[model samples]
Target: MPSEEHTGKSQPPVRSQPFPLEFPGVHYFDEQEIEAVKRVLRARSPFRYYGVDLQGEAEAFEREFAAFVGAKHAVAVGSGTGALSVALAALGVGPGQEVIVPAYLWVSVVAAVVNQGAIPVLADIDDTFGLNPASVQARISSHTTGIILVHMSGAPADAPALAELARQHGLWLLEDCAQCAGGSIHGRKVGTFGDMGIFSFQMNKNMTAGEGGCVVTSDDRLAQRAEACHDLGYARDRNGRLIFDSPELCLWGKGTRLDELRAAILRVQLRKLPVVTAAMRRSKYRIRQALEAFPQVALRRIQDPDGDTGCFLITTYPDAETARRVNLALRAEGIVTYPQGISNVLMTDWGLHLYYNIPSLVHRTSIDRAGFPWNLTENRGLGGNYAKGACPAADSLFERSIVLAIPSCLTRSDEDDIIRAFEKVLREHLSS
Candidate 1:
């Protein structure tokens, strides 16, 4: 049991642990990262120069990351959302088209699809918090151009199944690996399972570069398109040098470029990813083992436990009411729970309030008040209403689920304490 000395006034009156287990900060920088940034600063020339043939930090990081993920080509971009938008454009997703995405993901996923002048159709998720293949199949229409399969919270979705479905329908498959860096399924990494994959190096992600992203693909044409689309559609040669004489430009291209400073920091962070993911996996396993005795507490469905990056531990309760009670009990014991959203946007206990459910996309037919996309009579019929029962499975799961952010740097003692806290709370609930 935790001692009373650990209790704080803000926390409820319960046995307090010495360390209040809070979610780990996103920016976990070390001396190496600081030194890497300094080195880039010292170079003074951070901009990627064309026709130089010399590998800059961004290009070098791209090559290293490509090799690490077993991809033939890697294109670094400004951010994960930018990576997705560029990849979608590369895959030819444009107006009057649709892209299927899981309902449980961050708003950025939907935003990326909408930004392409396409309709984002929200699909239901399975117990793994990933897009259900059957749901995806059902959601696909004649206008559906692609599917964005997200590996939610470092857990690999049924990529093999999703891949087969995409192939059968002849739809482009894009892996949203924003949260699942260093994660794999079977023996293959999550990003490689799709035609093209995007990764985020955001501060809160498993890997960090403050704000950066990458698109990896083995397809030559797709790689070229992504490269061109990321840099305002500037024509580049085989060596990624700009062709100033080219009259061609990507219509959907944006100036989303990854700088050398972030690229340098990412290089150092990339090398340490395996070690960090391993530690997280160990901590999650320890916590899962401790909670195994409680039948009412179900661990999140993981397709490959060994392959999981273990960035988050999600448990489901028997019912939504039961989950609510446990949430209060845990908080009373000074245990932290996952926030509904960033800042102060509180999500409903049933999880009905979601990014897709916002009136702009759901109730209103047009993306903008001017009704540009929806006003096109051809597109009006394509847009679907995202009502309360839009994704029942995801809503139920969110209501019953308690997500815990697993830190990459946890000691054995810290893991043990976490296990103890969970066990204490579950036992109390079960007895009651």
Candidate 2:
């Protein structure tokens, strides 16, 4: 048995072999997660929580989570979407305002902006799959209120530059950590770079409570606003009473409270986060080593100045046909791969077309005029979206990219299986 210390630093030598046979599905949860849920069920009050009961756990979690993210404060919320909604509301974003977001992202991100009566200005992603600050700068109108930078798949956005851009332009920043919860850049956490950072604890996340999320900030006033907005616009009075029935409460409020049960589960999960993060890094290296020498497939690109990477493995292809073949091939071999297809509620989706009424950009339009361009490795015979004419670069990645699950609990043998499975898929596909 390899101890954490031994396995932690062991980076396998680069090689190409038929990936090994490993079971396909993920083992995301464990006894520790189960016990945490059990503790929540055993709590004194459980679900029927009040102001202080919820706030107390929130405060504690906020402190711990803030420390984890290297921020001054955090505010736990019901979901990652709720965190965005409340954070925007707390920042006073409303009708007649505009918010900038990447075109390629989880639908909830754009939904949060639109739901708040604000218009979403879509910007194209850069080579790293994050918001292009240049595109952001080009899209800024007088009505622009904020920028929601989603650090997609734990790849940190160009934080320092983006932060400076936001500050220079006097725009609010909301870091979306739905996928990259524990990711950091240059020895700093992802979410803490913006005005208010949001995190999701959805079942599939690196750290999860089945379904919960949080927001973090360094500003005291922002923290108070988040609490008030999440709790029907009620803040505690000096006498420990909710300061509702006041002129302020009448002005702003919403009910998106976090109950005690989720908090209890989260507390235990927080205790396990450090260990989980370490294992995730190790597992990522395992896959990276196997894929390093393969020219037929391109592994997901990650740039970490500190030599760290996210837990999951993402591989991009050149076109949708290749992506489909690779995905089908992997699935047939009992190894699952998630293609980076457009979200269900994208602009072209049937329902979204009617809801947002988004129009297609004109031919040769300046969509990528100010954005950085990036293309995935082309040899994989995967990538371009067969439907959307050609974004050869974006299409290639989205059409053929693969997402493999790597939970923190995987054993060394399991890790080896994952590496081998990927190599097997690539080698077979390449030879064919």
Model 1, span 1-432: residue lDDT tens: 323443333434443443322222243568998898887777775665432232388989999999999899999998998999889988888778888988777767777777777888888998888989999999999999889999987788889999999999999899999889988998799889899999998876888877999999999888888888999686677565676664544344678889888888889888988887887899889889888889878788899898899888888888877777666655556454234322111124323226445556566445567775656655667756576578889878877887766776667876776676677668766654
| Candidate 1: residue pairs that collide | none
Question: lDDT of model 2 at residue 87?
Answer: 89
Candidate 1 has its poorest 10 consecutive residues by lDDT at 341-350
**Per-residue lDDT of candidate 2, residues 1-432 (tens digit):** 212242232444222222221211113346765675565555544542344233355556767888888888787888988888888988887666778876456767766765665666666556676777887897787778889888876567777778899999999888998777767886788888899998888765667777788988898878888878876687766444677665544335556666666776677777766566677677777777787777756765566724243555666655556656655555444343224322111112322212122232211112244411111121122111212432323433555566655555566876676666566557756643
Give the top-scoring candidate (TM-score). Answer: 1
Q: What is the lDDT of residue 150 in candidate 1?
A: 90
Error of 1 at 269 (Å): 0.5
Show where candidate 2 strays beyond 4 Å: 1-43, 47-55, 238-240, 244-251, 305-309, 337-393
